[model samples]
Target chain A: MTRLIDVENLTLRFSTDEGMITAVDNVSFSLEAGEVMGLVGESGSGKSVTAKSLMKLNASNASYSDETKITLHLDDGPVNVMDLKTSKDMKVVRGGAISMIFQEPMASFAPAITIGDQMVEQLQIHTDMNSKQAREVSIEMLDRVGISDAAQRFKQYAFELSGGMRQRAMIAMALSTKPKLLIADEPTTALDVTIQAQVIDLMKDLVKEFGMGIIFITHDLGVIAQTADKVAVMYLGRLVEQGAVRDVIRNPAHPYTRGLLAALPQLDDLEKPLVPIPGDIPSPLERPPGCVFNTRCEEKVGDICSAKVPDFTNVTENHRAACHIYTQGSDK
Target chain B: MSDDVLISARDLSVHYPLAKGGLFGPKPVVKAVEGVNLDIAKGSFFGLVGESGSGKTTLGRACLKAAPITRGTVRYTDGDVDYSLTEIDNTQLKDYRTRSQLIFQDPYAALSPRMTVRDIIAEPLEVMGLTNGREETDERVREIAAKCRLNLEHLRRFPHAFSGGQRQRISIARALVSRPRFVVADESVAALDVSIQADVLNLLRDIQQEMGLTFLFISHDLSVVAHVCDHVAVMYLGRLVETAPTKDLFKAPRHPYTKALLSAIPSLDPDDPNKAQKLEGEIPSPTNPPPGCKFQTRCPFAVDKCRVDEPKLEHSSTDHVVACHRWQELME
Candidate 1:
């Protein structure tokens, strides 16, 4: 009930002009304090590069590899978020102990600032707040995210708000510095499914009033079965399964999570049909050497899922997966 | 009507105008398909749901006149073919653009990355002349790329070498290789992967019953338009609040903006989470909309005569219709 963020064999790579490309491959998982977790996949399946490598937010031809640890468990004790190493030690691991939110809240705001001056300049650059107590805690976190005239919608701007009020003013400027790990990534993929179900019931009421740890990312498996209390999945950039969102949405131990839940069309099933897991997911410079879903797997174990890389297998007691047809002697 | 109804519209509208106006600024326009009647019955599939400035891709490109019809009338017909998209010109709008096509919604910008999938599906029958040799356009682009499961040897490769459901089946084999007796598609599986969006919606409902064609589809995924539409319709800001038969709008969804968009859809039984009657704000600016039930600005039972009258879409039963103003007091 309180571990909050840890990762281990988390390898990553990039050196781009088409060379060492892996993007978060040996991924591991953990996150507890008010858990949410989900990651899901598709779209270069690295699930927003593992929630932007928990706040390092990759870029400049990213190439930091091997034993990629991360840690965190705070109360001023275990924080090595990959040994921070300056941007002023990643300002307490970005937004004061992690607070992401992305999939474009108008390209992460600043269309000439305003939403209460970009949430009082992100609570005066990560708190020790000033400017009238960061404009009274950014209009009380934009009236606790429902955002109605929250002090005149905090003086307006991100193109005068709406894409669900610029994602509830980017989740009230990433929960006005209340961060013990948030991440988000596809924050309701450019909204509008009733504003992505009111931003997933406002991130499940800001995870029951900020107990915090979310992670979330999404390629919408019904928004990771309604805001994931653990679920992992991803593909081409590996981490194959992980579980307990009702055991991977009711028993889905990877045939690419049962072809992404029989290619989901179930509003209580309308005479089922979307089977599609038949080929074509192979490119990040033609990756498929080993189960990056053995070229669209429909239970393929041939040449052991195109030559090895299976590992994980625990399959319940809160799931796990990876695949050579769920391992044990590899069904060969 | 077995003699296929290919296309229909009847009320249509496509608007646009306003580029930085002046002269007393009155004529501003941008309705983006306001009148909106529809038919598309021929080989039937029909869907169209909404949200994203709900014009459902400009009422599916103004029913293939490819936008800018601005107001009313369209007809098309098919067996013994008739026309009339309000005086079809420019060579019968280049012969109704080879019987109406579309398919778009970005397979990474609908493939023109230096063309290849055999010249982007034979550049729509070599720019609509249909097929004047290259062995009859490679035997009709190898029979619509093997009826879109694709792989007539991945047609000489390129769309950055496929995947996103094989470039949405090479954008549905270039909108069904000019055989198009009306197609539209628009958010063609809204950029794939929910298991390749139900395998490009069951390959557009098996190429609309194997090329007797018709389609339309557009989507904001109401459970993949209730398992691929047989008449759906919904839309919102630019009108048409209901229209049924997809199991009577998923069994009794008579428009309070189609039951808050089918209860803001996130139900895969995560212990029944859909508390969806959320809408209390945003979605107004269809250029200052919200006068008369264009969903009275985030409707929750909106009244005051629904902000001064304007509800008329009616027919609540046989073939559904709706448009609210208290959909009969939320259906009693």
Candidate 2:
């Protein structure tokens, strides 16, 4: 698999009224063509910030560390995303090379404009397609995403369509540009179980057909398990674990990862009692000194967990976790 | 109806007048919920699952008497009191408020941002005059807050100081503070992260057991429903299609809609084959739903009979009920 994007030592902070809040703390990950990377985290976990950083879409208040590097490898050459300061230069990273589908389809789409018009607008901005060509391509993409009577739907506004159709339309608009990377941020969270299943299937199919790298951001482990080739678990702005989805789900090394899986309501076995992490996630302003998740981690290693941050320990060939337990195990 | 049924509805319908009416023409009605019959056993967690526009929310609101019921009857029966919701006066309605309550989906929007957690939880007790004084209200709020796993100190702080899970707990605390025998939790945990969702689910189950409260748990997620609910009902386009015990519903769903719904949930096991019976179209518009079975438009097994004749709920077993013209034949 060819590398599509690489992020290294990406530390980001937001200057809030309260204080400087660390949103993404020294996170690093890479993606390859046609691969799906699941960035799993709850609110304030910095999963969204990490994904948004690819296109430099963070708020104006956000400040990144000087050592942080984000390199988007296009067909032409590798370009540092952080260096793209102007809108003209950033366009290559924004919708040109990377497209994003948000959780709320209504917000993403222009309610006043026809679905086709907005899609055409996006394609025009990203590609050299004329109005006619853009409309044709938009309708085709809409049909590809499973919208019945695509031609009729092309003339309809976002509100005219159902929630599922609106989401499908948004996906169609995103993929119509033929971008290399697609960042889907909780795309199916607003959808029903059945519609979500459809959308997930459509995304999987699109990935195979387009041969594009996808970053699937969601808190649902089941979605991650089914859709993601690789998984990264985030807790309180830190990447606690990263590995192949199978490995991470089967044998989670990080205590937080284990706790997350345990907390999920298992459909296969209904008798299992849900075990939530003992304590609440600490506020980002009051982030713990050592391991970010130590406040909620079940298998805390006493002083070591709260005193110093643990380095990543390789649990398997491609699986790694940053935890005192794994580090201690390796030392022994 | 069983003696243990705390709430029962027969042919319940909730219709809203649309603004599309002209000066002279008859006002068009948006049948948010139509021809729905349900029975909630005392101290049981009943799950209601459906897609958007499927009327789950409106149905829940109707049970709470929040939505105006246009037709049929709803009965609230406890040990001694038997009040018909449709025939209840102002005094009876006020008393019913103490016997039943609603937990909203969005914690952020549901709780007053300006008020502290204590005041938010205490509002219900004060509004309904459930407590004699501020001290009594505080005592009840503290008791319920503890049951929801909220710290006493945290109650002094505003809702903005808390996370989504904690805020949801506050909402739960507020809902249960009135000591209602029947509670309608409308997608209460949908807004929370999966990890936190489990915590709230466990808390709800624990509280239900302790308080002996019957919950009408409304959600669009099938897995969550299967995990928390003892029995489940499937709704589509303002109609009830199926009702059964959770295990039986999951094991062998008779309605095509139910079967499709079960299959659509992305399984934790990646190897699990995607359901072969993938539903095709979006749910038809509720205002102008196709005459007959609303699910027929998307059902793979839909026939001429299904297209013209609406199917009513029929019992397949002692506890299982389904609405499908060909359920018996299709099951074979």
Candidate 3:
């Protein structure tokens, strides 16, 4: 199992009008080939930011910490993605080794260009394929994604297709380059459930066939539970919990994780009252002194929780959570 | 099950004329809601579930008289007053506005940026002339804001100062300020984070209970629908495909579309082993819907009969209706 991507101590901030606001604080995660890691969080939790950071897609105002490091392990060699200063150097991360699909497929696809043309362009840029070859491969990719009349669809603009088809086309374009990793940023959020199901299944099958690692960023736990091999729970720009999807979901350690699970309206159990974590998520500018989630955490562990950030504590063999409850009386 | 029907919509249809007339003599129409029938019990949290172009939003809007009703009789009877929404005049419509309110989907866009939370909430009361004076308006605003868990100090601030969840709470407060008996929440929690969605949902449920209101909760998320709604109706291509109690619908769905929808929800349990029976193809175009059963194109059990003759909603059991020629056989 080769490491596809490894991000360490990724502290990111933006120079906004309000002040320097930290978006991703000391986050760390790695992806293995053919494994799917689900990044689950609410709005402003920076799940999307973390995914974007992988491809250096954050805006110009964004700043990275000195200790931050992003290593992309490709077939050729390991490349320090964070060190890539030029757009040409960054291209290897963008469409060569990694590809991304956004929530809005319509926004991703050009209204003027046909879906086939865009996919062909992606293939031509990443691979040594000619115009004719790219067109054949694009049509094949379109067909592979369950699109009927692929040739006919090849000539149709994005607006001509339905929402589900547009998403499928987006997926086709993203995967056409045969990248080693895929970052799907809420790819199905805008879609209907039935269509989302089909897309999820398609991505899963594609992962198996392509042997590509995927970082699936979404707020929907059900989608994460079904698709992800591992799950990472984020809150206020920090990774609160990281573990196997089953362990993390079944026996969550972090209070935030517990609160999230409790908040969800689970179909398996309808009798449980939805208990939202009290208090609003504190603004980034007015961030709590210590643990980012201390403002809303129900099980506050005295002054230490408010004084110092809790380090990650192992809950089980493959599960870990950042919480003061697990660190009580531990040596400094 | 009870004869306490607050709203009974019979043969409800909403049609929008196209800008350009079709090749034929008659102008082409977009049948947003075609031949829909529903009975919403008083004080019931009725869920309307559908994907894009399924007409759930249009149906909800029609109930509120926000969308034009081409043909139908929407009988609104709340013990105090009885009026046909479709045939209501200007005065009746104005009165209906006070009794029936709509909570929009986007919290960010729903609130006017220029107005303070207090003013935003009080606007409905003022516009309807429900409040006699400034003190009365303030009193009502403060009361509803408190119910929505908003603080008095917070009410003085603009919506831009609030978070997505907080803004949604404000939206809820604004909608409930007039003390409307019938509330239409169209994807109200869809914009919020998963954790915040639960908070807003709990708030909606609490308000409903406290005020004894009837809610037409329109959404695309089945899991969320299963949680909050007492009775759920499934829509496809502007037609009601199935209707049942929430638990009954999730437990034993009869219609193929209903069953497919239930299965399509990505299960929270990772090792459930129940492979999602993914529906094939996109939902057929609403502009030119498929003949007969709307779901026939994507339904695995679709037959020639399903493609030629539209199936009317038929009862399977008490309070459980399904529209499918082979629902009985499919259930077995």
Candidate 4:
């Protein structure tokens, strides 16, 4: 498989009124063409921030470390995402090679404009398609995404569509660009369960047909299990675990990952009581001295857990976790 | 009503009238909740599951008497008092307010940013006039906060200082501070992370057991409902489609909609083949729902009879009830 994108030591911080708080710390992961990576994390785990950095979509308040490197392999050559400073330069990455669909479709779409116009606009920006060709493509994409009466619905505004239909239209718009990479930030979170199921299936089929790399960001493990080929678990702005979805889910090595799986209400096992991870996630202002997850880690090993951050240790050939238990005596 | 039943609704309906299209044209009405019969047993955790526009939230609010009841009756029967929600007097309604409460979905929006944790929890008590003085209110606040695993020191801090999980706990603490026998948690934990969601769920269960409280847990997440609720009800387009015990419902769902809902939930097991009975098309508009069965538009096994004649709730098993024209045939 060809490498689609590679991220190295991507550290991000926001300059807030309080101070410069780290939102993503030394998080690194790569994706191959046609592969789906599920970036799993709770709120404030920086999964969305990391995904946004790929397209350089973060607000002006955000800052990235000098070591941070994001490389997108286009047909021409590998483009250094960080080097593209201006919006004009960044256009090659954003909407051209990487397209994003947000949780709230309404926010992404203009209320006054018709859905078709917005989709056509996006297509025109990224591609060389004219107004006529863009309109036809948008309608075809809408039909492909299962929106009935596509031509009629295309003329209607975003407010005219139902929640599920609006979501489908957003998906249609994103895929209309035919980007090499798609960053779906909690795409199914806002939709109803039945609609969520439909969207998930649609995305999987799109991946198979387009062979584009997708970064699916969500906190729902059940979703990740079904859609993601590889899963990267994030906690407190850090990547604590990364591996094949099956291995990480079946035999999680990190305490945080294990706690997440245990916390989930499994349909097959209704008898098991949900075990929530102990303690609350620490505030970003008062981040821990050593490991970010040490405060909530149930498998903490004495002073080392609180004094030093553990490196990623292999639990299997492809699965790895950053936990004291996995690398207890290796460093010593 | 049976002695074990805490709250019962018979053919309850809530309809809101829309403005007239033309000066002489008839005003349309949004049938939010219609012909719904439900029974919540004493001290039982009942789950109400449905997608958006399915009227699950409206049903929940109607049970709390928060929404206007256009037709039918909702009766609340505790040990000594039995009040009909549809026509309760001001005195009885005020008294009922202290007997039941609601936990909102969004933690960030639910809690007042200006109020301290203590003040937020105590507000309900003060408004209800359930407490005698500041001392009594503070004591009640501390006690419930402790029950919710909130630090006493944090009580003095504003809601902005706490995380999502902490704020949700505060929401719970405030709901229970009134010491209501019945609580309507409408998508309460839906906003929290999986780990924190588990924490809140466990907290809710523990409090339910300790206080012997009956909970009406409304959510779109079937998995969470499966773990926390003893009884489960499935709703569609403002109508109840299936009602059964949690385990029984999961084990053998009779309604096509219920079966599709269960299968639609992406499995946690990676190897599990995706056999989701994907419900095609979105739910029909509630204002102008299909002539016969509301789910016929999306039901995979929908038949001609389903399109011509609406189905009534029938006993599929001893305690399970399903509203589907072809349930028996589909089961066989």
Candidate 5:
């Protein structure tokens, strides 16, 4: 398998009125062609910020660390995403090699422009396609995404479509360019469960057909289990755990991951009461001194948990976690 | 009505008239909730599950008498009083407001930014004249806030100063301060992080148990409903398709819609083969719904009979109701 993207020591901060607040702490992960990686985290977990960093999509106030590096391996060559200083230079990563679909399809699409026109515009910008070719490709993509009457829907504005259809159209537009990597940011969160199922299946099929890597971001672990080949669990802007989907979910190494699993209401086991992780996620300004999850973790070992950040320790050949319990000499 | 029934609805419907479409032959009406029967047992946590446009929220509003009851009757009875929601007068409605309250979904928008947490929680008591004076209101506010796990310091801060989960606790504190007998939590935990969502859910459960309060928990997430609710009801296009004890409903769902819904939830076990019966097509528009079954368009087992004559709710088993023509055959 070809390596599609590699992110190393990515750290992000924003210059705010209050002061500089770190949105994404040191985080690293990679994806290969045809692989699906699920980025699971709650609000302020910085999952979105990390995804945005891949395309340099953060606002002007945002800044990245000097040690941060993002490399996209394209057929032509390897491009350093962090080195893209201009919007023109960032264009290749933004939509050509990487396409993103947002949670709210309504906000993503222009109310005035027809869906077809917007898709055609995206294609024209990303690929060497003419107006006529782009339109045909857009319609084909719409049909491929299971939108009925693709031509009619092509001419319809975003408002004319139902919530599910609008979401499908968004996926159609994102995949129309045939990018190497697709970043789906809670794409199914806003849709109904039934529609969410349809979208999830559609993405799985598209991945098989297009051989594109996908970074699926969602707070729902269930969705991740069904879609992602690998999973990365983040808390308070830090990547706390990463492993194959089965390993991470079945035998979560980190306390935060275990707490998250315990908190969820599982269908298979209805007798169990939900155990919420104690305390709240600290605000970015009050970011915890050491392990981000120490405040809420039930299995806190000692003062070391609040004194120093633990480095990643291997739980298995393919699974790893950042927590004192898993560290060698953290208790001392 | 049984003595245990806290709130009951018979043939309930809520329809909203749209503006005339250029001298239309007949004015269009959005049948937000139509021909429904429901019973919420006292001191029980009842879950209503549905997708958007399925009218779960509208049904909840109608039960609270917040939405106009266009037809049928909704009766609320406690040990002290019994009131029919359909024929409620201004005095009774005002009294009813003190007994029934709603917790909205978006914590960010639900809370008033200008009000301090203390004032926000105390407003309900002041509006209802439940407390004697400023001191009494403050005392009541502190009590409920403490129950919601909000500290004395939190009460002095504005909504902007707190995170989503803390703001939600404030809202919950506000709703409970008046000592309402019945509460409607409409997607209350949907906005919080997974860890915090669990905390709030546990708080809601604890509050319900301590107060001996009846709760109508409306959510799109099935897993959350499964764990928190004793009984669960599935709604589609403003109609009840199935209602059963949560255990029975999840273990052996009779209605095809309910079955599809349960299956659609992505399993946490990655090794489990996903045999989800993906329901195809979006929910039919309320204004132009199909004549017979609203879900027939997407139901895999929908037949000719399901297209011409609407099915009525019938007993699938003791205390379990299902409205599907082919449910029996499909179950076999």
Candidate 6:
């Protein structure tokens, strides 16, 4: 697999009224070209924030730590994303080479502007296409995402379209720039289940056609299962497990991952009721010293689970998780 | 046997008058719910599923008399007292309001941040004049709070101090405090995290069993509706496309819309790679819907007939009712 984007020791913090809150705590992962990677986490797990950090879109209150290295391997050469200071310099990493779709497509668009105009604007900014060329390309992309009457739809405003159409338009605009790395932050969260299903299918197809690496972030386990090839599980801003989708779902070594799977309501399993993890997610300020999920974990193994942070242990060649139980097994 | 029929809606229609009465012109209207018939079996978890603007919520509220019904009749019977909704006088409506309650979506919005948990839960009882005095109200509130798994000590603290799941539980307790026979839990756990969602769901199921209460659980999530609801009703553009027992609906959805809805959900198991059913386009606007089937715009099996003629909801089997011209064809 060809390496696309490499994130190493990426630590991020936000200066909130409470304290210096660590949003993405020393999280490290890499994506290969054409690989669909699922970033699964509950709210405040820092999935979206970590994706935003790639384009340097953190809020004004965000503060970065030293050694936060994020390198993108483009066709030209390797570029350190953290060091790209100026907007001119950052443009290469932003919409030019990297793009994003959001949970709510309406927010990504101006209500007053037509969906086509927004796409054209995005394409124009990133490419040297003329208005006519942009218009054609935008319409084609819209059609590609399953929006019918593509030409006439170009004249319609965001509100004039339904939620599913708006979502498709947003996807079309995001991909119109043809970014190598697409960060979709809970793109289908706001959509209806059926509409969400359609959006997820479109994304999987887009990945195959466009051949780009996607940082797919969502709390829906079912979506991740259907779309993602590899999965990375996050808890309180830390990576708990990362592996091939089949392996993680089949055999989750981490207690948190197991709990999450058990908690999911499935059709095949009506005999057993859903068992949610015992307690509420701790506030970032009250983050545990060692294991983030120790508070809610069913298999918390005494002081070690709370007093010392577990190291990442490879359970399989491609599967890795941070837990002491796996460390007790023979090293792979 | 008769006691099992908690609430029955017969051709219920809720139409809002668009406030524009010109000098000599009649007021225009927006038909939110149009001729809907439904029945809630006693102690049964009934799920109402629909996209935005489907008017499912209005249908729910009309049962409680919260929304004005322009046409059709709604009958409410708790085995003891039975009243026809459309013909019911103010006195009977007031008594019904105390028996049928609403659990709002968006816990943060549904609950008052200014009020403590105890007071929040106590509001419904106080408002409806259910209890004789503060002592009886506090006792009832505390009892439901315990069943909801709310911490008694935390009841003194405001809603801001609670998490989404906790706040939702408080919402449930508040709705239940009036000793209502039925609850309209409109998107109750829609905003919660996946793991927390399971917990809240389980809580609801347990509460349903204990309280012997009928739940008109309204949500857009098929997976959630599948697990929680005994019976499921699929709505689109102010009409019920299909209604069946939850298991049967998931296994074999008769309506194209229902099948499309089932096909749209992402399965959680990575090995269980179920591709989403890709619909052609968006749902049409209710005000300017297509001449025939509302789903015809996006229906894959749509023919010329579908574009011009409406299909009445027909039963595929004893319990299953579907509205589609090609439902039999699709089953083949």
lDDT of 6 by residue, A1-332 (tens): 78999999889999988889989888889999999899999998999999999999999899777988998999999999988888899989999888999988778789898888888987888889999999999999988988889999998999888788888888898998889999999998888776776787789889999899999998887888888889999999999999998999889889999999888877676656788988899999889988888988888767878888888889999999999777655543
RMSD of every prediction: 20.6, 1.9, 1.6, 1.7, 1.7, 2.3
Clashing pairs in 2: none
* Model 6: residue B71 alpha-carbon error in angstroms: 0.7
**TM-score, second chain, candidate 1:** 0.39
Model 2 preserves the real interface contacts to a fraction of 0.73
Clashes of each: 2, 0, 0, 0, 0, 0
Clash number for model 2? Answer: 0
Off by over 4 Å in 6: A330-332, B1-3, B19-28, B271-277, B302-309, B325-330
lDDT of 3 at A78: 97
Residue A67's lDDT within candidate 4 is 99
TM-score of 1: 0.37
Per candidate, native contacts kept equal 0.81, 0.73, 0.87, 0.87, 0.85, 0.85
Residue pairs in steric clash, candidate 5?
Answer: none
Question: Residue A136, candidate 6: how far off, in angstroms?
Answer: 3.8
Candidate 4 per-residue lDDT, tens place, B1-332, comes to 13399999999999988765556767788899999999999999999999888999999999999899999999999878999998799999999999999999999999888888889999988998988999999999999999989999999999998788989998999999999999999999888888889989999999999999999999999999999999999999999999999999999999999998888888999889568577888888887888899998888788899899999999988789999988888878
List lDDT for all candidates, in order: 0.80, 0.90, 0.90, 0.91, 0.91, 0.87
Per-residue lDDT of A1-332 in model 3, one digit per residue for the tens? 98888999999999999899999999999999999999998888899999999888999999999999999999899999889999988888899899999999999989998888888887887889999999999999999999999999999999999888999989998988999999999999999888888899899899999999999999888999999999999998999999999999999999999999899888788888888888778887777888889888889878988999989999888899999998984764
TM-score of chain A of each: 0.39, 0.99, 0.98, 0.98, 0.98, 0.97
lDDT per residue as tens, model 5, B1-332: 13399999999999998886548477899999999999999989999999888999999999999898999999999878899998888999899999999999999999999999999999988888988899999999888988999988778889998888888999999999999999999999988878888889999999999999899999999999998998999999999999999889999999999988888888888777468687888788898889898889988998899999999999988889999999889887
TM-score of each: 0.37, 0.96, 0.97, 0.97, 0.97, 0.95
Lowest-lDDT window of 10 residues in candidate 1 chain A?
A323-332
lDDT of 1 by residue, B1-332 (tens): 26455677776777788777777848677776677776667877888888888788887877777677867888887767688877876887898888888888888887898878988888878877777778999898888889887878768878876667788888888878879788888778877777677777887787788777878788887888888887888888788878877887888887777787788888876788887576766666676676777777677678698888878777878778887767777788
Tens digits of per-residue lDDT for model 2 on B1-332?
13399889999999999888879978888898899999989889999999888999999999989999999999999988999999999999999999998999998899888999999999988888887888988898889899888999888899998888889999999988989999999999988877788889999999999998899999988888989999999999999999999999989999999888878877787667575678776887777889878888898998999999999999999899999999999988
